[model samples]
Target: MATDELAGVQSVESVQSETTTKRYPVAPGVQLNVRSGPGTGYPVVKVLPTGVSVPINCQCPGTTVAGPYGTSNIWDNIANGQYVSDAYVRTGSDGYVAVRCG
Candidate 1:
């Protein structure tokens, strides 16, 4: 029982750590696009100039595309409601680097 409880706690901690906001820079000259939602289908909300460092709030799976980080579908939440493809940022993780957005 103790082991099971400890395992549960560890799982929660992992999830919490994944959700922790992380700072990342826009790939140089990418002029990354911000979307209202997590996909290209979503309207382009804004554009961030190159070298802008943003706080990644979370991430969710979105449209896949080849980018500075190679091909990926993960979209990162950079602001309150703004999202940009994780593929365009240099997170160094080709896989999901943050907890999926709810």
Candidate 2:
């Protein structure tokens, strides 16, 4: 995919609050690993498949977007807009519902 394509994906807004606007990534083949805790050092969370776009609720306590293998991000939901977990988030723009992919 082109770099510009990923730009459309939701970017994290520095100032976040109950009324703050939020965004999430949605890309195909976006690999994600839901960690037991904030950082690494636990079992993975189902190895999410491609097109599986997680929501970004809020930013993690101490996490960055720079990494070698997978992408780490904090997300929430579109309906509730609640920040939940810190999982491996990919830069995409689609796929909220689960669909069989090869």
Q: Please give the CA lDDT of all the candidate structures.
A: 0.86, 0.40
- What value does the lDDT take at residue 72 in candidate 1? 87
Best by TM-score: 1
Runs of candidate 2 exceeding 4 Å displacement: 1-23, 63-65, 68-102
Clashing pairs in 1: none
Ten-residue region with minimum lDDT total, candidate 1: 17-26
Q: What's the count of clashing pairs in each model shown?
A: 0, 10
lDDT of 2 by residue, 1-53 (tens): 67766654433332334445444453445566554444444444445455655
User: Each candidate: RMSD to true structure?
Assistant: 6.7, 15.4
Q: Model 1, which residues run further than 4 Å from truth?
A: 1-20
Q: How well does each candidate superpose onto the true structure, as a TM-score?
A: 0.76, 0.37
Name the weakest run of 10 consecutive residues (lDDT summed) in model 2: 93-102
* Highest-lDDT candidate: 1
